[model samples]
Target chain A: MDTWEKLDIGLVMTVLGMGIVFLVLIFLSSLLGFFERLFGTRRSPAAQEPKPAAPAAAEEKPPPLPRPPSKPAPEPAPAAAAPAALRPAVVAAVMAAVSAYLQAEALALEPPVKRLPDDLSFWGRAARLDQMMARRL
Target chain B: MSIGESILRFLETMGFAAMTWQQAVMIGVACILIYLALKKGFEPLLLLPIGFGVLLGNLPLAGLMAPPVYETVIDPRTGQAVQEMKEVGGLIYYLYQGIKLGIYPPLIFLGVGAMTDFGPLIANPRSLLLGAAAQFGIFTTFIGALLLDFLPGISFSPQEAASIGIIGGADGPTAIYLTARLAPHLLGPVAVAAYSYMALVPLIQPPIMKLLTTKKEREVVMEELREVSRTERIVFPIVVTAAVSLILPAAAPLVGMLMLGNLLREAVSMQPILNRLLKTAQNELINIVTILLGVSVGATASGPLFLNPRTLGIILLGVFAFAVGTAGGVLLGKIMYRTSGGKVNPLIGSAGVSAVPMAARVSQTVGQQYNPSNFLLMHAMGPNVAGVIGSAVAAGVLLSMLG
Candidate 1:
């Protein structure tokens, strides 16, 4: 503050000085706007990137929502077929979880796919990227 | 002139040494700043108040701006000065006190913590790296500031420079809190720089984001996130609060509030509490602080304090810092895209500036333009949220190094 007070110019003068600078900046910004319209390069195809237009559509794709994977078709299907009294609570639990996701508006990236089950055979002889991903970008 | 008249004349002349025209013009400029802040959505919350505060603080004999820290007051009904205006401090004075003593900002961090969502960041730990990368801009600005001795009326020590550098994070509360502690004098410039550039993020980020990432890169879509289990969600806030508090005691207040808010939201049993907190976060707290923060921050821009070449230098350096942060985010995004075989939308990289979901929203908005099916918000949230932690960590480093 002592140094500030010792400065030769008064505060009002300093403010006035900056006000001029602000005006110049505003004016220059407007001038650039005019020139940009006059000489800016035209938008080209390169202006936008290409994606896997049709091929991405073909991807069997992950299910779009967070769905619990289909109840296993394996013979353990009786567990899903359990008695009605026990099933009601299980069904309510599932509904609540699903509702929570919906309420949170959890954005599923395009389609949510269940990651394939873990298996040494699947891992050892994995299908090509296109076979697994379904969509090609 | 008579002796009394002559004394009056001499004083008036001395006062007029400032020139009424210049003062009036300064006041006009202050009003214009106020108008831009209010009329333009350019940080209207803080800018409007700050601009008005600047105008009011500088006006002579308006007697409103900075009432003497303590002043005489009268109670007409009681016919007494019953309640002395005991240096309770004028609004801007109190605000400046908050900044000077570093009071409100840390509390603000607590509120911010309560409002934040760390899940996205937790889901994608790599966003933390991008967030950290963006912090490079803060230090870069510090180096740029070192070179700014060539500018007029600006010479910051290393600590002061570091305080100013955190403005690159584009987190106003943290910047103010940090500067208030490390370099109280530069708080005026640093706060101005942080808030002004934050308002300019839309204008500043897109160009750098475009320049750094290819069109293909922008269109990359991230895989869906797994269900972050309820217990996993609940543990997030508790663990982070403990981790951050134990690790960086300075960041505890902010992290605690933020995580506490998330805890409220995730606890699942506290719907009423969540409703109350969510409403306050969205409305009351934001509105009140925004009014105070904006104006008070603006008040720092009093004609003398703000009307310097250093302030100008800070503004320019601020843009550079923002650009650097954007560049870092997008570039790291490109790297992630490559490593993941184009599974990451580099646009999410731009969310690394920690504008609290705004930058993340921008990434989501822009990505949808490139690919209608793209859902980048949660992905962007990773870096967007990490940017908050990143800035807090940066603040901790500055405090420890220069506290």
Candidate 2:
């Protein structure tokens, strides 16, 4: 047979066959997902997907109260003294992230910041810090 | 005529084009591909039926093909209308067409994009440099193959050399697409080598990864990846595809398809629609193209031509290319480790050769052996994904020079 004719046959056969196999795979994955939804428990690969929308509010809303206090906390003060080379952007970001996570944790206590006045900025930072620390667990 | 010569003369007179012995042997070999695909599941998703189609073409008097001598078809009944065999067209003829037209290879790239994750690379942009470093093997092999100008019937100009050297990257579809474009003659051996060695990545990479990385370096635990925004993921593939296509039009089809698949995935706002569409329609796109691509590759392996000395040279060169790519990644990884001083893990360097997540997994696995607590998967993935982009870029560069 000519080259084109030969290629056409091969293409049809291959696509058809492989298509069947791929469908089987998707079918299986869906079935697996279905089973997980029913009787089985499935662990997804992604982490930190649900950031507790209310807690996130606490995170975004409050920082100034903890801020003036953290202003006096000895650690952020030492960072102020360190040389620029010693405290790179990454290191600073990491420190802030840790501090932020700690502040978030402080806000998520059992009381849930009920009636702590209109300004709950400190409580929000404490809540975010709680989530960050909880991530380790 | 003796039994052998009589069989040969009959086949020659019949215009079968190959000696009966050679035809029989190739037919048997085709059966093996089918077995590997169907039973052993060694890339059976692609190989199994490709093998059967190849066997059908090589059979005597079947006229499952246009035997070149007579425009005739005896009843070789699979009973499809096309199987009624009005004239002559071999099974191989049909399979070969998709490859020559550059159809199946690009579609295969679409599936790859759907499977890949560029998040790791973006999270660690330095890994992009590692991916670029690994591409040294591709160019190095090009020079190596070109230097083989001393061999008869086996010389490669710059473009042909670039095309052939890509076998070392261990990316089957890309290698096929490039060779089909730049050096069609070398396509058969090159594709075979690319697939086989890629399957062997689990076997090949660990040793090199072990040799190059000191145990202490392997155990370096990397910081976890920070969250990448959905917006960034959506933008990445589009940016890469548009940037690459503008520079090298030849690579656009394959690269463009891959990037689109990635975009489809990361556009989370459209996830429900995409998930439904993928489930109902496009997800199987992966298997279908693999089967078509595999058989098309196999159909090109005609007996005398397929068994020639040049094919053997390619097999040898393919191994050389794979090794060189691995070494380049490992050596550079070590350099980065030293330069970064304990902060960088040298094992990640070996993942730069674009075998995708497989190479990265090996880096992580080896790292675990040194320090059981060392977790390098996320870090290794950075270079692994970058290797994919790097190889694609390198491919574009070569096509411009040669195509």
Candidate 3:
């Protein structure tokens, strides 16, 4: 084939190749969407509803605990200072372990939590700290 | 013969006496590749073996890549002429048959399929578009390579151009598979260029990604993906394999093997026996294929053929393909960002270039640079895995057209 003919074929290939790729993938996307509609709803309600309620219950029960204040009230300054000093190291260690475990377990299991929210956001960090404090109490 | 004459004849047979400047230069190139693999840690698993293969290939007297020698002989009883094997070929020549026969790449894809988690992809299927868009680089480079036929000493047939273009897919096995079928002559340079650029993805993709997107677009924190059900995951490989194979039968071997591996991985939850198969595919089988594929491919890079203007063109076009692919994905991402009202992070689009988790990680790193809280890894993985399917499809298209 001459240069122009080859170039024409090349252009045709360019269009045809890109067109087929898009078509196939778009088909796949819609198929996945269909699957989500079909199967996702079945599990989402059962999986999602209980999680928020359990966390909420945990939140409520933590506030009612009277043991935390009683033990630390007399030495509040030192108690606050000690945890403040130790918090960074502990959080860092925990984050490392969590990330390592998540990476190792990513193939086999669903993640325990969907997102690594704590390290990335201030509110998440605060919520985690609150949970830790409540657990200690 | 005198002792001195015998010694002198042995000296004349040595590799040093037969070595050319091109061979010397190729050896230097191999050493540099080895250094990059060892010291700088550039895709050490493949590059190290490939570099050593180049070294072995260039040694003039070694004959490591020699083809089998055959002679015509007459059978005494039958009185018919038959071809007799006079000498067996070299080790790598035998290993190279795996690539030449189109066996190794699909097997590698099987391992990749077994190892990959398609949950992220199934959750956000629109990322498939980004994967398809990145393939724009492959076709664009195809046109560019064809245009290079006008240049002096750099003629590329359409088959060669297609093979060269696949390097832009940033997928080493697919490149080799396509090249071995279409333009076996260009296999060495194309494979080298493909793997080298894949290793350099972090360096190549970011600048284009940054250039294409705004600061706000890069920092867009995407919502967490919905949970994919076990049934959905299991059905995925089957459906995809059926759809893609029916649509493009030429892609069956690759897509078929890939889905089979994935089926093994995902179906283990139901059939416990499949776990053994999945483990083998993911680890041992892949490792053996990788070594053979790397060394045999590198052995094809003989001094005379490799040190040429065409090889240089392939190397240059490789980077061009990667740049355009990154740009293509990022541009599509920009469109998605606008359409989604800034919900989509455009940075994740660059991961569409099929370097597996490496491209995805680059997206994450670049996104984190702009916004500390932005977690694009899982989001980017959607496109990252999608790119594999996209490239395989692109290869199918080219093969149907050219092969």
Candidate 4:
């Protein structure tokens, strides 16, 4: 076929192709809309059953609900109190352990604690010690 | 033979001795594609395999894409001549049969259906219009490709024009499927153009979107979509398959497979056993098909056939198709915006071009730039998935007319 003839065919195809595409999608869109109306209304009553109770619960429990938020503040306080109550016992145990270490030191049963370099930070010292230990291993 | 003769024969058999300038150029093209896929991250899953396939196809004397050889043999007992297999074809040659026979594209669609969620589309069915609008790019580009025939050294027949125009659909599988049927010769350039443009969606769409809509329309924060029920999701794919297949029986392969995959995914909620099939379709099956399809399509792009004025025209027209499609969607969106009393964001309309989450994300990103609190991702997804159906339908229309 000649170029012009092909062009004419092309023009027709362009219209047909776009027309069919639009028609198909529009058909699908409308079908979906129909489904929405069909299924949507059937489920609405089940969905709406909860609506009345939600507002009634809200009205009756508004004061009670605010207390829950404030209740969390004091909840953490009891947790803190338990730790505070254990402090004296912890200190006494630590003191007893220190005395036992002192007695051993007096008897020359152990070496004195090694002083770490002042220039190194705790993390840096820990890293350096880790490297040294690794090398030794 | 003497040692010197033996050495000379070995050297002659080397790939270096057989290499042509065309083959070298193809190697360079392959490298460039590889670089784009790796460094620039342009559709790496497909492009990377395609680039390597191009490399393998162009390697001197590799014969990786060679067809099977047949030989005539005499049957001594019967004193008759018969054809026998002399040599097997190359790996890619066999794998390419899937494409040539038009099998892979629909399989890929199956995977896409499994991965996709149609709830957003069901929630806002109006998005289907945007999907249809975006298909305007395909037909417009078909005319543009035909018009290119008027130029010197660039002629496209109606079938070739149709294949070239499908690149505007911005869908890789649909483009491949249509091109394989309509214009197999144009598959390489068309696939490359379609994928490259799909990867470039962010770049191509924003300008058209900005030009079409005012800032207020872009900034329009859309309302949240209503919840879609399990029953609607289950019914959607079945209804679509029946409707589309009835209307355009030609599109049944692609649209039917896509809806089937969607049904497997959606119906799994009730059956639970179908989840295994859904998982396979979504992941393993699709991944295998993608690799095979990518390599075979790339192998078709030999240096001599690919580097031509027609390819250049196809590349140019591809961008035109994408731009026109985006504009079409946005224009329809602007209409929806007016009709809906500014409830619809025009930006989401561009997602109708069917690049999936990428196009939808672009809508969200652009919408957010205008209004930070605005979220258009879910809203845009409605049209994004709808575009897949629209493009498949458009492809069916073209195939019925041209095939």
- Give me the candidate number with maximum TM-score: 3
lDDT of 4 by residue, B1-403 (tens): 9999999999999999999998899889889888989999899988888888888888887888999899999999998999888999998999999999989999999999999999889999999999999999999999888888777889898889999999988999999999999999888889888988899999999989999999999999776678888889988999999999999998999999999999999999999999999999999999999999999999888888888899999999999999999999999999999999999999999999999989998898889789866778899999999999999999999999989
Q: Cα lDDT of model 3 overall?
A: 0.88
Predicted complex 4: DockQ: 0.26
**Cα lDDT of model 3 by residue, B1-403, tens digit:** 9999999999999998999999999999899889989998889988988898898888898889999999999999899999999998998999999999999999999999999999999999999999999999999999999998777999889999999999989998899999999999888789888888999998999899999988888889887688888888999999999999999988888888888898899999999988999999999999999999999988898888899999999999999999999999999999999999998999989999999999999998899889866678999999999999999999999999898
DockQ of each: 0.02, 0.02, 0.38, 0.26
Model with the higher lDDT, candidate 1 or 4: 4
The model with the greater DockQ, 2 or 4, is: 4
Q: Give me the chain B TM-score of candidate 1.
A: 0.85
Q: After superposition, how far is residue B58 of candidate 1 from its true place, in Å?
A: 1.4
- Residue-wise C-alpha lDDT for candidate 2, range B169-252, written one tens digit per residue: 667777888888888766656776676666667677788778777777777766566555566567667766776677557668
Error of 2 at A42 (Å): 28
Residue B216, candidate 4: Cα error in Å is 1.6
lDDT accuracy of residue B122 in candidate 1: 52
Real A-B contacts recovered, model 3: 0.71
Worst 10 residues of 1 chain A by lDDT: A75-84
| Model 4 alpha-carbon miss at residue B29, Å | 0.9
Native-contact recovery for every candidate? 0.00, 0.00, 0.71, 0.66
